[model samples]
Target: MISNSDISKVIAGVKGQINEQDTSLIVAHLPLLEERLQYLAKSFPSETLHAIAIKTNPHPQMLKHLVGLGYGLEAASIEEVNMAMAAGCAPSKIVFDSPVKTRSEIDCVSGLTDMLVNVNSIGELNRFPSEATCTIGIRVNPQVHTGAPEMFDVSRNESKFGVAISSKQEIINAALAHPVSALHMHSGSQMKDLEVQRGALEALKALADEINATSSGKIHTLDIGGGLPSEPLSDRTRMAEYGAIVHEVFADSQYKLVTEFGQWVHAEAGFALSRIEYVLDESRVFIHLGADFFMRDAYTKARPFALEVWNDTGEFVQGEKSSFDIAGPLCFAGDYLAHGAMLPATTAEGNWLSINGTGANTYALWSRHCSRTVPKCIAFDGVHSSIWSERTTINY
Candidate 1:
């Protein structure tokens, strides 16, 4: 777990490197990242492919680090597949899962060495080249809503994500028609109930069984889409529990498991620092980072980001605290990152506000509404810090 002291140490070391114009900083703690990976590795079956989701935090160096750690990358688009390749991940270790894959995109990755493509629908599956080298899979929507936040629930009956289980025959037929060897299911994100995930996997297994019961096609892989709830960095028990559930369900099954977790792998491993530009009425504060970098937090207050304060001299501010509304620089009526967030009472202009649990979706979902420049991201490994991405102008 990255504490305030950990962030302070990184800030003290890299304060000189941060640009004045740069209003915010993103810190990626390599140790925490490794902790998540190690936990998953210990919890899951040895044959499991823990494909880290690139859409969560597509920091290039971070991707490289995960690849070097022996984890695969799950790409939602061909561009992400290319990024996974650029990060030194082999094509065999990448999973392309675009719901709206174009013919050009299909043709682009088809020749890659042992790539996995999980088509979302029968129509998309038909877009694949007949003689491509890539292995195919059909994404199945379990249609079991886990009551995850509606915005993140992809398994809704009317969702546009995958082939609904109501069309189980169509999915099974699609697998039979195409060279599909895998079945994928990603119910939603930030779901806390492991049973919900288990239910979804059970549905996936049932479908795979029906498909494999046929003589022509077989489902050798079960791509359980990643929506595992992210625990605090300090709690290392959820992965083991999740692993137990999976093992209990598929102990005798021969299907290979492929997980694509985003927040669970990176959420607590990173933090965001934004300079306070104003302190209005001692109850409202304005920050340099707004909806541009924190789209989900701004749009929905479901994000569980912890807040902290630091003085200009890089010391953690820890005195009496007060409730304050944190507002971003974006010009919108509902651009508040947090309502009544507690912070040091003395927090004022120039003081830095630290947002914990931002290592996952915050920066990756960066919006261009305000045209704010992308901030610099620095990776820290407890010994040294290096810039993962430098702050730059938003190129239109």
Candidate 2:
């Protein structure tokens, strides 16, 4: 977790002073993003291509930086594909992993170097040309439950994510029919438990073996889709163990490995700071609308951030604490950021809170139900701040 102290330090270091009254913005720490890339590099095989999930935080600058760091792009949409290309990421290095692909979208990427396309269902395979030029694969629902939130878990029996592995013959038939060279499975939970991950992969690997046997070594890449838990809250040691589990699973298989990690790489490097709007009571505090900025936090209503309050004068507020209900500026009744969050007794209007550990799935999940434009992001190179958006207008 990037501590409040860390965020405060960065906010303080901005070239110009930040106005607490207008502090609803995100600070992306490039150094932290770089460090995470380095750490993930160590955890995977040297040959593994770490494709950063673009839908997690599709900042063009971040995309370009990751490409420079030898990372690839995992795109879930054609627009994301264009973003990756604009970032100078090689077509081969990008993995098209969308579950819902229109026929035109399938026809567009007919030929690309070393690219992997993991179609969602057996039916989706029909959209591809018979001689399409990229490595194609089918998303296999391993059906290994991760006990994650129902929405996050795609391995459930009724999941609509992938071709049901339950139809054993159909899965085999798809591999024999399509121009596939890989087998991909995404249990789609940020489950950090090593044993649980291994169990899921074991199922996928078995299916891959079955496919490879039928295709005479056609399946050579195993794309274990990424859903590692968020940083700060996620256990790094557990991730290391999970890495070992992956290695152990394919010790004897001669297949190239691909990873598409999103949350673990970007979560720790981002945060949102909101200005205090009102103080309803002794303990009920309200800030700017946050569902339009940090929907993951709003959707789950979990206080995943480490709260730090700073007054309008940029003074860090510290004193005896009390239960503070930090509400959002939305019209809904359940827009509270923290239900009974503990905060400084001095916490009130004219004081801003810096929400930390929000790099991934935050702004990318912003909602505009109230016609709220997403706040501009300030990218920090550890010393200065600059708007990452192209123009000053909030164009949500």
Candidate 3:
């Protein structure tokens, strides 16, 4: 775990000739990554089910490592499902979750395995292939919103993620009438409160009880979809707390409980390294580096209340720490990372700084609007290190 001071020291000794085209290098501590995963796995164990949401950082090697550690994959698309499979994940260990599914994607994965599908509507339930032996899970909206406004706003009544709890009976009726196999529910992404999770679990358990009562098919699986918050700066919910919550919720139930987490598993495994391109002002500095336009990689996306500043050197200049803005090299004004934040006074031009505690595949969400090549990715397994991905130079 690199400390903020260690990062400051690294920036203090930058001697390389930093350029705009030069790839901003990143180093992933695989041992730490493995350790974190193992800790979470052991903390929850099979008693409290856990699955890796594939959307966060789907590098093949990362997925392979995670799957090898007994974590299941939660795939949102056919491509993600294929990626998980290619990474040596068995279809039985994959959960095909998406509110909207195309016929082709459904047909392709239909006969693969008894993977869980998170259904959101009756139409999706009706469209499921009857021949496919699937453990069906319905995403119920608990209507209990948490997290930042951006995250909370999406879980509002108008949001299109899951079916309302009031309408859950309709979903259950449709499921019982069809080839349903399991029950699932997700509140929203980046949820921090335990009560929110409890609410979601209560809803799922109620549905499970109803299914067990009225239907011939057994509800053997309960998937508590992952929205576990991963705030790099603070601990929202500890692994043990999450474990306790799960244990309490399913104490009386016989169903297998499963959880899908993306950010929680990979957020602190890697860092995004960039160099300070130029100092925009005395208080505001511009540390320019290569990155996709995704908010997850940049802090600005998650915390809109915080200010961002640019710094040429990763270190902060003396007395100018409180007012700074960090921006990427993209042409758009919204291509900023952090703003109005404290920085080191010693920061200068040509210094390399990292978007500390990020993942190797942070660029997965970036777009090619300005035709910039994707950044490179490197993985370090304590003693040995290797380049996991080469820099993207193509302009398509």
Top model by TM-score, which number?
Answer: 1
As for TM-score, the candidate ahead, 1 or 3, is 1
lDDT of each: 0.86, 0.79, 0.66
| lDDT for model 3 | 0.66
What would the per-residue lDDT of candidate 3 be over residues 76-131, giving only the tens digit for each residue? Answer: 88789899889988777899887678877777777786788777776777676788
Residue runs of model 3 more than 4 Å from their true location after superposition: 4-21, 45-49, 147-154, 231-237, 280-284, 290-323
Error of 1 at 153 (Å): 1.2
Q: Give the TM-score of candidate 2.
A: 0.92
- Top of the candidates by lDDT: 1
- The order by descending TM-score is 1, 2, 3
Residue 161, candidate 3: C-alpha displacement in angstroms: 2.0
Cα lDDT of model 2 by residue, 355-383, tens digit = 87778887777787687656667887776
RMSD in Å for model 3: 4.2
> Model 2, 107: alpha-carbon shift in Å?
1.1
Stretches > 4 Å off in candidate 2: 15-21, 233-236, 312-314, 390-396
Q: lDDT score, residue 357, model 1?
A: 82
